[model samples]
Target: MTASHTPRAKSADTVSALERGLAVLRSFSEDRPQLGHAELVRLTGIPRPTVTRLVATLVGAGMLKPAPVADRFMLGPGVVSLARVFLGSLDVRGVARPYLQSLAEEVGVSTYLAVRDGMEMVIIEACRPRTSMLAARLDVGSRAPLPVSALGRAFLSAVDEPQRQQLIDSLRLQRGPEWDSVAPAMHRAIAEARDLGYCLSLGEFHREINSVSVALIGPSGEVMALNCGGAAFMFTEQRLREELAPRLRTIAQAIAHAIGGHLPALP
Candidate 1:
């Protein structure tokens, strides 16, 4: 998923039914809780009969379940079950395992990979050293808000200024339960990160955890980040500045190389 992996040229081929079927499945969301055949036809602009057939097929396949209210369908346990398997197979951990281990070993802390997910970053992989003090046990699926975590700032640093500003504006509009006091400082942090090569969060996301991060852009220019984290007392400001930041830049460059693209100059 990095610059080293060139993307295949787009094909002019027609859309496949399977692709359309998946799109139909994706069209339903929390807002549009239940969908009927006619509603799906209106939403997808697919023919009514085809929508009906696909809905029936999906229902039979257990990807959709009949709603308690008559004549509606909702996403089923089958989708959740399949999605778990898919996420487990994503292999970000496999790709980042050695690098994260190396980073942890060098820094004597823990490292993690977090991918941007809408308004938050989801921790996809984590490598922790045996001796490091952990303020929190960040599991694979933990979600962290953008304004609080170094992983978010690393991603924000790589994005264009306009998008970064927009996300900051959005953050100003909403505040997390624990972060009302920290939001303004986080805004400054984001701007600072834009100026600096990377971002650092010092006990901002969690009370006793500190993290430093650098961004990685994939071959398609999609942004991801690598974050090294530990107890704030152990991962001191001096350590982040004098040690961890330099090593993170090296790991990110390696990831970009492995992923394939025109690599950006290291900051």
Candidate 2:
């Protein structure tokens, strides 16, 4: 879901229940999977009573399940069914499926494929190395902030200048004064992605992790990105620049070619 796909305004026709229900569902993510009732209220900003009702409803529908923790819940098998239906529908994911496993094994790290969804990048695919003991913890359907992630920066670098400006402006408005504080770093990252044909994230999203990424034009004309990431101990700055970046660029190109999409080139 890019900016263009977002509706300009919500009308009276909108359903608040549906919105709140979805918000409740979206509150569950890789980092916060088994949240208690009070935690859900804090995460969703919905009233505790409302959260309780929604949780009960979702549990009845089998979309959520009670966890081992006394009052906590996790996504249920029903959610996996829904995810399977969505993933099975994506031709791009199907095309890149084999390559994802191969690339993850080759790099000995976790890899992800993501696309812009409103103001965030949503991971739609993930692959982990066969023998690596380290867990990257990013899961399909998880969302990350667009301004601070390698995948997001890659998408930003791939978009047209006018659209990029519009996104930056929106970020400024949404973030208020804090936008100014992070703007320089985000701009530097975007420029690095544009110049090197890839983006780097060293302890930006997580303190002990590092990654390299590049974006591709999806078959539907949306921007999509691919990345490889691991613990910082396994990836020095020199190795990320000299080894991982080139491999990431090659992977992006190969995936782009497979999907008949455009690939960015290193300056």
Candidate 3:
């Protein structure tokens, strides 16, 4: 199931112009870093004229700038500035980085710490084994799908029941016909997380990748997750379950203890 870049307004007080403008910005991604008004309109479902106006305003506000190519625009310094502020505010990243790096080096794999964003998990900290040539090609801003990714399922296991159900309902709506096929695996992942303090994604998110993840809760109850894995050939389901999952759980506990965070109780 594909997630929408544009968010739906949940209330009557929503400012549609602001929403549309944000949608225009959200249309830019790692794969599609630059877009023209026509592209924005197509991706965001906004009218062309509205997209044009939004682009003009965004460019004027320093949130976007013309790309090297004619009529195309890319996210600008303003977005970077905002991202810096957001990253700066995430204290957990600071606490988790060393542990993540240690795990990556020890396991000869990649490790990531992420938080939920709508129907996806956004990586805040990504670490790789410095001595190893093989690692997952993901960085701080990379996103993983909620239902299919171990990181995302671990996040689901961390949240309260109401929030989890709300997110699931939203996923159902977003996935449409695909929900039937996706639900069973997602439920299984959730169950694993609840039962074992971790979740596994064996070639579910990317057919070539396998990962295991554990959830963390901050002292004030903020939710986050950590995942470790690499190429499918190196991280088989048995290896993940027997070898990596225990270490991953230890790192989760260590991070939680360091940050005064909490790990979900296993049943």
| Winner by lDDT | 3
lDDT of 2 by residue, 1-267 (tens): 222122223569987776676777777777778989887777667788998998999999999999998989999988999989987877788766677778788878888899887678998889888787564688788776778888888899999899999988877765676887777878998999888788888878767888888898976787899888888888867788899888877777788888788776557
Residue 259 Cα positional deviation in candidate 2, in Å, after optimal superposition: 1.9
In terms of lDDT, the poorest run of 10 residues in model 1 is 1-10
Candidate 3 per-residue C-alpha lDDT over 1-267 given as tens digits, one digit per residue, 9 for 90 to 100:
132766586579898889888878888888899888778877888878888888999999999999999999999999999999999998888888998898888888899999887788999999998775545688999989899999999999888899999999988888889899999999999998999999999888877889999998989999999999988888889999999999988988988998898899877
Tell me which of candidates 1 and 3 scores higher on TM-score. 3
Candidate 1 residues 1-267, lDDT tens each? Answer: 111111222367745566557756765754577988877876666677887888888899999999998999999889889868967875555777899988777667778888886567878888887776574577676667787788887777678779887877656555535456867667666666666656789988788888888777777777788888788888888888778887887787787777673223434
Clash count for each candidate, listed in order shown = 10, 0, 0
TM-score each candidate.
Answer: 0.65, 0.80, 0.94
lDDT of 1 at 237: 84
- Using lDDT as the measure, what is the rank order of every candidate, best first? 3, 2, 1
Ranking by TM-score: 3, 2, 1
lDDT scores in order: 0.74, 0.80, 0.88
The segments of candidate 1 whose C-alpha lies over 4 angstroms from its true place after superposition are: 1-80, 84-92, 176-180, 261-267
Error of 3 at 236 (Å): 1.1
